[model samples]
Target: MTPGIPGFRHARLPGADGVQLSTAIGGSGSPVVLLHGFPQTHLMWRHVAARLATEHTVICPDLRGYGASDKPAATSPDVYAKRAMAADVVSLVAALGHDRFALVGHDRGALVAFRAGLDHPETVTHLGVLDVVPTLDMWNVLHGVSAAVGYHLFLMAQPPGLPETMIANSADVFFGSFLDAWACDPAAIPDGVRAAYLRASAAAVPSIVADYRASAGIDVAHDQADFDAGSQFAMPVTVVQQDWGAQLGYDAAQVWRAWAPDLDHRLTRAGHFMAEEAPDEIAEAIRELLAR
Candidate 1:
């Protein structure tokens, strides 16, 4: 079934004190905040949110550097840190007058949700992470073809000058590659969305690189510290991933269980962008969990 999301309205919600995040809110009921991945805005949640809005209010936001948001200078990881991004979620909810809400995230958004779950479990009633693992587990599993499957991870993690220059030169090809590679149905991405992603990525090359660079550097440290402390997401977390590590001798749920004590993990046949590839299932998963 296809979801019909006509359009979205914008708001710059008060977030993390002085920081205001650009957000898109629609419908009404118990709130569900949807955070999207790299090279995508709140639009990624458009289709899913449309279906979700039938029963619940949905909030979709361009996390910091992605879309119609305040692209602040990320001089340090503390500022651009996933933890900081998580704080944006917490404050955004409060600004919208919701004390607690269900949170859903895809790709980079999933990483942000991971941080939010650990840092502010009280604010999130349910956590659904789509298409990515915890930072440290991902680092550990980046072996063999898994590393090759994510070559961009290493390239994007480079310092500002290099990735910025390289991707800036061929923004379409560089950014579009993931669009084709990750999605099972690339045709499902409209030209407007594709063009929008290209434009945003081109303009935010430095910050995008810094985002991944932090994942390689400080993000790693944060995840490692959590590992050393035997800490994981402190919530009823559900993980949905495209079993990428199957060929690499790994079980997705087993690995996720190590990070989420109260976990409900699902392995889907769809490609990496499960929200786009399997919206009905993803939407149902959120609906079911929210009911509980």
Candidate 2:
């Protein structure tokens, strides 16, 4: 049996363009949607979702091309673009009877949430981003030897055939490397959960690579357009991240402040996978964001 959020009921909901999203929904009252990061699924939100569900209806969905969600062929660049994925989030929420809701995401999902805030400001009431800057800024900040930390981003950004072939050849080592390297506390991901993440990621290598490849091409272009137009998020925004800027030679908060003027930028000791490594802190931060 698949491990899931304790109190949530699972469903396959329709996303944008008729794609299906595997989602876990629970709780009641005002709604909040949580989007998972790469190499994991809706299951990443189990701890944080349970806590938020106590007061707010929490919706957790496996983004298209990840987890049990439909992995449509990346026939075109836009298919895996963050713009399209953000549309999926909007559609998924509307399908669940929510016209507007608080939106939070980690890693790749955070990229989608950032775009959603800019593109559909009227729909996302509050925005919470964990452990990543916007895509445009992300690409700009990485340079020289420090960029080695993000080598996978470059590898997967290559044209379709080679990346898919290389990653699929040793999917476990590729996916597990991130899970192991990013977690400050290794025990945060138990054996069962780790196995589940590996299984899901191994099966979705092609789509996952497509998702990253879009970030390199289409995602950057979209972000560039928004930046050129001086677009900013029109809602209260909270960002929780480790102090990566210190090592990477950039001001993390300043980078986010440019995009989110009304921003509450926080630095956490937790590693890249802050949601799982520090659920209580993450949950409390979300509560505070919702209150604003």
Candidate 3:
């Protein structure tokens, strides 16, 4: 069986819009739900959650269409939109009996956490995002280095059939590339974790592609509408990212400031997978956000 967060118990919880979310529940006290990023599962939160479990009820759920979560057939491009994914998270927390909670997400999960904070401002008390900006800001800032480094976003954004077929034919190499290239300390993602990610991703190619496709199309529209409406997250927010904005010639904090008025943005020395590469820092950031 797959190893998991040491003290947590697993469950397949019914989620928003008929998605079944694979979740890990543990701890007691104020609730904190953690969402994982691309090419990974809730297992990505293993190290971080273990530490937080001592003081908070930590709930980690695989975003629908990832890991053991049910990947429903896409009825439309918007089906995998972060708004829908965010709803799944909100519902999972409610089912567990928490009316409101702090939320932390890494990568794509951060997008969902962002949407959750925006769409349900009263429910998400504090939001922490790791390694990403808002979806609209991400696309808006892309040019030169940002475009080059983020080529996968465009690749997966293509019309469905092509990206799925190509990625599936060389699944291991495609998925492993992210795990290998994004980590500054390769030891942070050991063989076992890497293997699990590869296995899960390879088997869910289409759904994964659809998830990214939504970002390029419907997700941007949703974010744009929110942007035009002058809506911003009211809850306290913390963001830690690799200095992609500085490297890519954009101001990361400046871009994030528009979405989060009460924002604490920092650059990380750790690579893209900061939770594993620097669990103490991520855990402490969540704790500090919760304390706020």
Candidate 4:
């Protein structure tokens, strides 16, 4: 378990479609659910959740196929689609006695949170995404450098057997690459936390690849439909990301603004793992989004 994060207790809850979600619950008042990104678990929310818990009932869940959550056999990418993952979050919070709540996510979890806001606007009161753009924009904005930076997206998008087998054989290198490269301060993620993330990701290699594979296929289709319908996020939205647009030659804020009419976008020097590298900043961003 993470060192501090006061008053939080963990549990396993049933998610949508028989998947199980390992969750951490604490505090009281208005509810806020935090979701972790790839190669991490609910523990990634250690500092942010603890702070939010003081004023809000903070819930952190390991998205299905990550951490201690159930990794159902992948029949198709559809099973790991962000839509399905988003459903898991909605069902999990509802089961935990929250009909509506503010939602926050980092990295892969941010993609799921994006889907949750689009799929259940009434249920997600406010949305906060750290270090990511929407899935569709993510693909559209990619060119030379951005594509190289997000190499895993294409590596995992490859036909099933190869990516999984390749990743499984070199799990440490595959997962460790991100842990080492994606942090502004490598020391921000404690050795213990880093070890835990590596272990969990290594164990769930195939399922994790399936999750990314879905983004390239089914998840894109869903986002396209939403975009075509001109669906907009009806809630307050906050986005924090590295100046990827500057590095990648696109306007990150403009991309997010297209979907969220009410948006608060900020560029940070913090690396991809912003929640861990700058927890106070991330927590304050969520509070600001909630206050809106």
Question: Of the candidates shown, which would achieve the greatest lDDT relative to the real structure?
Answer: 2
Q: How many residue pairs clash (N, CA or C atoms closer than 3 angstroms) in each of the candidate models, in the order given?
A: 0, 0, 0, 0
lDDT tens digits by residue: candidate 4, 53-75: 88999999999899889999889
lDDT of 3 at 223: 95
Model 4: ten consecutive residues of lowest lDDT: 1-10
**TM-score per candidate, chains pooled:** 0.93, 0.99, 0.98, 0.97
- Per-model C-alpha lDDT, please? 0.81, 0.94, 0.91, 0.90
TM-score winner among the candidates? 2
Question: Quick one: ranking by lDDT, best first?
Answer: 2, 3, 4, 1
How many clashing residue pairs, candidate 1? 0
Expressed as tens digits, the lDDT of each residue in 35-149 for candidate 3 is 9998899999999999999999999998888999999888897689989998998888999989899999999999999999999998999999999989999988888754888
Tens digit of lDDT per residue, candidate 2, span 99-199? 99999999989998998999999999999999999999999989999899999999999987999999999999999999999999999899999999999
**Alpha carbon deviation, residue 207, candidate 4 (Å):** 0.7
Give candidate 3's TM-score: 0.98
Q: Clashing residue pairs in candidate 3, if any?
A: none
lDDT of 1: 0.81
Instruction: Give the worst 10-residue stretch by lDDT in candidate 3.
Output: 243-252
Q: What TM value does model 1 have?
A: 0.93
- Candidate 3, residue 177: Cα displacement in angstroms equals 0.4
